[model samples]
Target: MVGGIAQDDARENRLIDLFNLHQAADRVRHGTDAILKLDNVEYEFELKSATTNKGGISTVRDLGPGHIAKWRGKHWIMAFFEGSKLLYCRYGSPDAMRPWITEKWDYIKADFEMAKYVPAHITLDTMFEIVGKKEVYTKADARKIHKNQMSAAQYETAQDTVEGYSPARMLDIFKDRARYVIERGSTLNNPHIPSKYFESWPEIRTNHAAKLRELVSTWRDAKP
Candidate 1:
């Protein structure tokens, strides 16, 4: 069942079907892709597929989802793939994933300005008009505009969902969303607690392999 797949996304869907995981009813935008139940308890999970060229390294596009999930005090699964080829998945409480997430967050944040920003999505003509130029908007002018745009875009587009997922936009929205989640999830009596915790990465990986093997063999033989 996994001989050759066209795309990583297709392989993700196939993995879901193979495992009989209940897909999320709607897009958990900037969140995990689907749900998995083990022992009558459901777990939300994000599926990721990275190219095999990096010696089996997968990547996360945005730390937003992981941050939001952790702030909400939810334990989740993270599955990895190289096309149709499955890889080890992590199943842990947020407490367990926190150190890694923090490390990654720090790494990504190293390039961040942590300042105000204003985004201008205007045409070159408008830009030239603003600069009061009749003709070419030279490279020098563009450089000035770029600097202004990068610093101000965050403030202007914090809640702008329709904004494109540029790095600036993502930083703006994710920071805002993560902040809100943290405040909403906290209380005087109730503190962050992760349930359904499992820390054995090896066990999760082994189970997935065996389950997929049996599933693929049975599904292929049963195919018309």
Candidate 2:
């Protein structure tokens, strides 16, 4: 799904070199210095006080000659820091954040178990899809789906005779009825969506719609 270099090994090597140059015994002790916080583990030697001591920052020194994970033909260094209260940081473009930041930590810690299965972009896409799709449906299928989903009392009131009204017109009226119910926070049989549907709603719908759009584009491109 991704299109580009996932990781640049030469860049990673330079980062490790820089870190060793500044943090290792070679440099003079001075004021607080900032590092380029790369996609590697930093091992911090615990001192007497946690606050006083800068937390352990691991450098990719050992793996200087090893290969990292490759995704979509692009190289990415995949590492894990093992210690107490570990903090993983990545400095670069948004792509660097995808494997961990956006995907791993967006939700609750308990959600991490689910995170193993769900990627960040997927979750984000789901959210975007649902919102976009809801808007699309509101303009497109809302009235029809609303009519189909409504109940007896609602349908009775909704059936006021309109001469020469097309199905599309009827649907629009039904959707308006549903929208009114939603705005008023009224309870009705056959509500437009179930309780849980409201939680993710349009985002999931929107991503699916986008996937469809992409597929259509692909099909058109493939056409002879």
Candidate 3:
């Protein structure tokens, strides 16, 4: 019975160690807000909704849950917590709590760093000057931008795909096609684009290039 109990304890310790390692990795990747230590935590405040004015400035009111408000030199900053750290993303205005709604969380979390406290958490209707209009890029514009950004081979693959070339002929072609639409620009509304490319496009587009490469490698290896 004692030996069995010892084994159980060892197993429990191993699990705990694994959990800690996982948490450490998460902290490294996602950052932390350390809510308990308000003084040490820098918080961002955002409104639950937006209202626009004649100048095309948008104002946000009401704080989203877990969003903290803090005052800087001349402006009110609102932000949300990811784990224990303030979420890092680009804000459109001085008073905006959340980053632009369109930004991917994975991209935002890449900016996490060591925890430090700035004043956070204020529950009130605060007025902020909206910075400017959010730039609206059409699907075509996005594609053109992507074309400009692609390598010579990637650009060739994209042009070929648009012209109804099947990327299935080669793994490099397939991968390049995927990067053209998914990474360089969105693939929305292009009927000629392959169904297979779209199947994993959403996932591949959001991930880093290394991840996309791994996915492409797996798909290539599976191909007969």
Candidate 4:
């Protein structure tokens, strides 16, 4: 949701080109990266990148509450990766995803009250529950990942911008987190996820391999 073309821009841009989708002109916080015209309807998708090695946690860590609020009801297209190798991409609407995750907002508000703002995120364990962790990471058919390394100029602008900021203080800023939970998906709940949602998916939840086969069944016909 960052406005500028950051390190992940390379990956986002490539996806737009590869899919024959138009790139959004003005990239901003809580904004989309690509556009599509299907059946005379305009569709805007918020693209996200997750490293397979990192438990599908987003490469971009700036998904705050407001950003997420703006993201609701929009289509999500996430590309998985291992190092610089791009894996499969997945698409789903909010309705299709609602059952899989639970949102926690109370602790998020408390954190802000204490002068610390935690980022918000959707629970992805449901994705793992529907498919499996291995299915998302292990299979790379042919395509390699597109790397989007940030330019030096943006780094310079962001560096030590805080007043009276010392190198040590800057290091601390990177290390610090709120006393309350910062991970919205990881908060404690009466009924835990993956477990609660597990019983619902009888077809592929237990047989994770079926999830991969299922993707092939509905595979889209296109060229890279």
Q: Highest lDDT: which candidate?
A: 1
Q: Estimate each model's TM-score.
A: 0.41, 0.15, 0.18, 0.43
The alpha-carbon lDDT assigned to residue 20 of candidate 2 equals 37
Which structure is stronger by lDDT: 1 or 4?
1
lDDT of 2 at 91: 20
Instruction: Please report, in order, the local distance difference test score of every candidate based on alpha carbons.
Output: 0.45, 0.29, 0.27, 0.44
In terms of lDDT, model 1 sits at: 0.45
Candidate 3, residue 71: lDDT: 18
**Per-prediction count of colliding residue pairs?**
7, 16, 15, 1
lDDT of 2 at 106: 33
By lDDT rank, best first, the candidates go 1, 4, 2, 3
Deviation of model 3 at 6, angstroms? 66
Question: Candidate 4: where are CA atoms >4 Å away?
Answer: 1-6, 59-63, 99-102, 106-224
lDDT by residue (124-218, candidate 3, tens digit) is 11101111111332234334334455565654554434443332222233233334343323211211212221222223222222442343345
lDDT by residue for model 4 (133-188), tens: 33223112101111122244533343443333333323232223222234433333
Model 3: residues >4 Å from true position, as ranges?
Answer: 1-38, 44-170, 183-224
Candidate topping TM-score? 4
